[model samples]
Target: MKKTLTVLIAAGALLGAAGCSATPQLTNEETCARVKTVVSAQSATSDKAGMTRVANQLRPIKAAASEDLRDPLQTIIEYFDEAAKPTPDTAKLEDMKADYSAAGQTYGQVCGTGQ
Candidate 1:
């Protein structure tokens, strides 16, 4: 009886360990689908408040991006963050735009869409 109980406990421990293993990572396609949803919500609004809203919307895209697109999405987020600032510097904004555009072009090459 003791031997049988020991075997049952070991089996239970193995089952629990298996259940606690890390979740399966998202595929590039799955990550892109989630990114698309967040990107679609972005608008071309120039006002600080509007840009702030867009930045908030874009926050999730960074988290959902695949490895290939992560840096580009991060750059885009930084652009939005800068644009949302109350007193954004024009020169800095231009620099950020260049970075954002370059990253966007890279993303386009990979994802087939710049927007």
Candidate 2:
């Protein structure tokens, strides 16, 4: 019960943070934009099922977007993993690679990527 509540709260907090809001940590726009981009890219490649799976997997981990790099990056990688019956988009994948690189660089320089 405790764990479930914690997860629910985290999901709600993250969902709220993604919408337009003034989260003291970082603006929701920043995190939400990244998540939107990732989801859009996956949808462009795979079927609805794949997109849904990624979205479902991402909901709980979504909180990491506003705080750290590792969790978001890991979530993005999970999206990549969930993609099915679709080929990778080289250009979009390149952009994702750069985003992941940014997160990794941040992790290397700052704390452990907000983990």
**Separate clash counts for every candidate:** 0, 0
Any runs in candidate 2 off by more than 4 Å, and if so which? 1-59, 64-66, 70-85, 110-115
lDDT of 2: 0.56
Q: What's the TM-score of every candidate structure? A: 0.64, 0.32
Give candidate 2's TM-score. 0.32
Per-candidate Cα lDDT values, in order, are: 0.74, 0.56
Model 2 C-alpha lDDT per residue in residues 5-39, reported as the tens digit of each score:
99999999999888957424433455556555555
Root mean square deviation (Cα) for candidate 1: 4.5
How well is each residue in 6-77 modelled by candidate 1, as lDDT tens digits?
Answer: 999999999999998855555567756765665566464667776676667756655656778778778887
**Error at 46, model 1, angstroms:** 4.7
The candidate scoring highest on lDDT is: 1
